[model samples]
Target: MTGIKDVARAVDMSTATVSRALRGLPGVSDETRVRVMETARRLGYVPSPGAAALASGKTRTVAVVVPFVTRWFFAAVVEGAEEVLRDRGYDLLLYNLGGDEAARHRVFETSLLTKRVDAVLVLSLKPSPDELIRLDHLGRPVTVVGADVPGWATVRIDDEQAARHATDHLLDLGHRRIAYVGGAVEGVLDFTAPAARLAGYRAAIEAVGIAPDAALEADGSFTVAGGVRAGHRLLSAPERPTAIFAGSDEMAFGVLRAARELGLRVPEDLSVIGIDDHEMSVIFDLTTIAQPVREQGRIAAQQVLAALTAQYWVPEQVVLPTRLVVRRTTAPPSDG
Candidate 1:
């Protein structure tokens, strides 16, 4: 059978307007409504239960947009959210922003504008301020995971402060000259982890009254391979740093591998610290900033569900605290 979307297409009206027209609801012009109903009846268009529920006020579903599903952080968030959403009888419609900037833009500007979902839960998307405002006006609640969106309720970690704390851990161990290994995936602008971490690293150096070394900045790709390439470049410098602060545990693992290849001793020759306590962080003894990724996911889903269920939930930015996890990867500078 034909659908409201088909009828909407036939009459060149929105599915929402078509739905209102079919259900005899107010807000649509009588002429347009007549055209939509006529098109639907003549074309044998049948609205699905989900659309009907929407017209009647219910769906038990939320739309989740994420930058990447393969990434450990994003995957962890989804796993956590899935568990919560599934338990509460809420359906999740996951939209993957497949590692492409253009694809992400299309997903945000077009795909998410659908009327199928009840609420929205966005993962680490930093849309332009204008786009975010437009989303706010879409008449449904929104929740952000892994970062803050000014007007919506956000469940995330204190990324900047966590990075700063990680830097302090390295500094406390007597390492003064340090290089940064930042995991900045190419293409997505929604997440500002790299910028925030860089700020924290700079802030920490300034707090200790050490001049920031612009030469020590190296971009890693949030993978072991990316870290290895970055590590080689940073290590090959004329003035190699005695310590490295990697933006992620995965990148830090790469640095460790590179150090081993170059016959450098861990903590004795160079110290390394990273953010995100990946499962392997402990196995590799990587000192890191540990944030509860899964917990953030669960909380974000709860916020979305609350919005759908008409429960009282204040839209506020909730930053979960992070702690510095001390491991064997850090030590006093040997020359000191």
Candidate 2:
């Protein structure tokens, strides 16, 4: 039954000052803020979310829309965003669209409208013009993670550059016959990641005066199973590639699995590299381009929180950096 009044009395401050301090609003000195927080914690005075929402016109909740919660990148981003939101005395409302068009439509049309959140953080799901309009109608500040959307705050890595760097690494290792494993070239709307990555791979190959061959490209769909299937098709060719550049570490792992099934030694027979230094990448010894996936999520969450608190309202794009991680899976082509 402890309330803000009890904390205010313990801290010898007015209810307004206690509220401001708890809500992290300005006009409260750091000393006062700390004292109020300590007193509130000591007294077990928890602010009622409903009461706070009614008083401040803010639900103190952020809605996160993602295509797939089960994926490593999305899961990591969600964890990072949740950490920041929880520390800021806010809650997270998750909406997993499951990468299905119908599910995505239902979420934007119905689920989002019914949610009482102050801001929305979309992860890796590019909203079309119509979907964007619908989101704007929600009247909540929106922040996107993964790709830049005009007129909205975004935090993302340069997917094309990351893919190019991975490809260049293989090229530098004297890999003339380098194959690419990524998502399908077509059959999706509002999703440009696959195309961007494919472009990067081709750019790297062409920069080296090598004609990009469609035969060397296979659609992995950004999944382990997809990579495994792609790997079989690529390796079954009469003249297989000396190195494989997978768009994701999961796919690279799948490639590794397929190589083993075909009695191919990594680096010796087929060097493999990938993007996203996923947690399992170490176990797989995958050479990859490491992007700050969780950090991007955290930054996106911070942007939405800033908008909700009236701290930052201007929309901006934030592009994080990626690094080439040299691991056991990548090496100079045996022919070299």
Candidate 3:
């Protein structure tokens, strides 16, 4: 089998220099790095992951923590992170909590203690104080997605601003009785997006000199079925809202279904808007605030890599932009 020594001999470089170049370590000149790579390729020499780990004390693996792997947003983020990790010659370790408290506990308490990963990338989870302390004990680089954490790298959208944008669009269409469907559960430990979005919804209405009504706020649980339930409850009221702002496109899809079941015409009798331009949004004709879901994952992975490579790296707090995507579901209220 071809080896590093053979490549180093072919390139007339020291084994240490070749090793440094191959591992992408600093202090190697660009010209020598390129030559070592070309010679290694010519000799078909492949570095063993175990040997690399032994040399650098790095596992060459990153762990990605998600609430549920089946969800669209989580799945898309994992796909994007995997792409970057694969290209950078790293392996991914996935921790799927599945919304189970025991599973979440086992992951943060025991599983992460195994030292199997060099870094961690968390998705949408606001860990408890104990959990955060446990993660801090790991002494490894950690990057969070969809939530902000102190002293850690984060990649997320401005949830409050995005929600405000969605509500403002409805208000501009003369929707005074706008109903908000969100995913928050009271007295439950969860992520921060739902609360931030709910605040934004209230802020938009209050800005226009309107008092926010608790009756119009429905918990959609960030799912299509939940949206359907919320939709029915809101539509059945004596004074139904002409417009609804769902926290996610999945919920918006449910609202559309509910509207259809109730024999109402979209944009004629009712209009709806949502956040996250989900893959199925086009089919649903959902007007939404489009966020770069997959891009957030890619950026989080890049952050992990940057921390791994840099000797003195500062944790980054990256907030991406969201834009309103006008589609067939939103329009001026029929009365207007």
Candidate 4:
């Protein structure tokens, strides 16, 4: 069987140097590290995980905690993170909560991940006070995506600004009777995006001298079916809105479906805008605020790698930019 010693010999480096390079430890020159990695690969050397962990006091594994794996956003982030981890010689362990509150509580309240992972990457969850204390006690590096937490690295877009942009687009098109479809302010999972986006929508309308109306806002629950229900409710009201701003592309798709069923012409009769620019958004020709979802994941993974490899590293809060993508779905409201 191939071993580190064999790799060291083939690369003409000492066993210690080979080990450090393979483990992605500091103090090795980049050129030497590359040569050592190439030699190890050519020699088909695979280090024993158990032995390595014992020697280095690190499992060289990162655990990614997510609400669920089926969603496009979560899956994209994981894919980007996994690519970075693989390139850096780390293994990824996924802890999917499957959107169950009980499952989420158990994962955060226990030491299930303490010794198994070198670091953790949490996605889209705002940890509670108790959960924060438990995570702090873990003594492991934790980086979060889509939520800002003190004393930890965070990577996310400005959701409020994105929503404001979406709302502003409709307002710019002279639509005063605008409606909002979004997740509840207080959801079971306690996600950060919904509230921020809702705030943005309110801020934009208020800036235009339009008082925020409770009747115009509906909880879409960040899902297609929820958006459809919200859409029907707003459209069926005595005073229907001329435009709708959905918090997510999936919900926007639902709103579009609802409009079709109600025999409303998009852009001409009921303009719509959404966030996330999901892959399916193009099929619907939906205008949206596009965020770099996969890039956020990749950056978060890199932050974890930095914390693991550097002798001294400070946590940072990285906020990426979002942009408005124009499409066929948004236009000035018709004079009915």
Model 3: residue 218 alpha-carbon error in angstroms = 2.2
Put down candidate 3 lDDT per residue, 200-263, tens digits, no spaces: 9999999999899988999988889999999998988999999999999998989999989998
Count clashes in each candidate, considering only residues at least 3 apart in sequence or on different chains: 1, 0, 0, 0
Q: Which consecutive 10 residues in model 1 have the weakest lDDT in total?
A: 183-192
lDDT of 2 by residue, 92-156 (tens): 99988777878777878665445488889988767888889889988888998987787788998
Candidate 4, clashing residue pairs?
Answer: none
User: Which segments of model 3 are wrong by more than 4 Å?
Assistant: 1-21, 27-46, 111-114, 186-189
The clash number for model 1 is 1
lDDT of 1 at 160: 77
The lDDT ranking, best first, is 4, 3, 2, 1
TM-score ranking from best candidate downward: 4, 2, 3, 1
- Per-residue lDDT of model 4, residues 1-336, tens digit only: 998889988888899999999888889999999999898888889888988999999998999999878877899999999999998779999999987988897789887987888999999998888888888788888999999887779999999999999999999989999999998788668889989999999999999899999999999978899889999999989889999999999899999999999999998999999999899999999999999989998999999888877889999999999999999999998989
Candidate topping TM-score: 4
**Model 4 lDDT, full chain set:** 0.92
The lDDT for every candidate, in the order shown, is: 0.82, 0.87, 0.90, 0.92
Each prediction's Cα RMSD?
9.4, 2.4, 2.6, 2.1
- With a 3 Å backbone cut-off (N, CA, C), the pairs that clash in candidate 3 are none
Stronger candidate by lDDT (3 vs 4): 4
TM-score of each: 0.81, 0.90, 0.89, 0.92
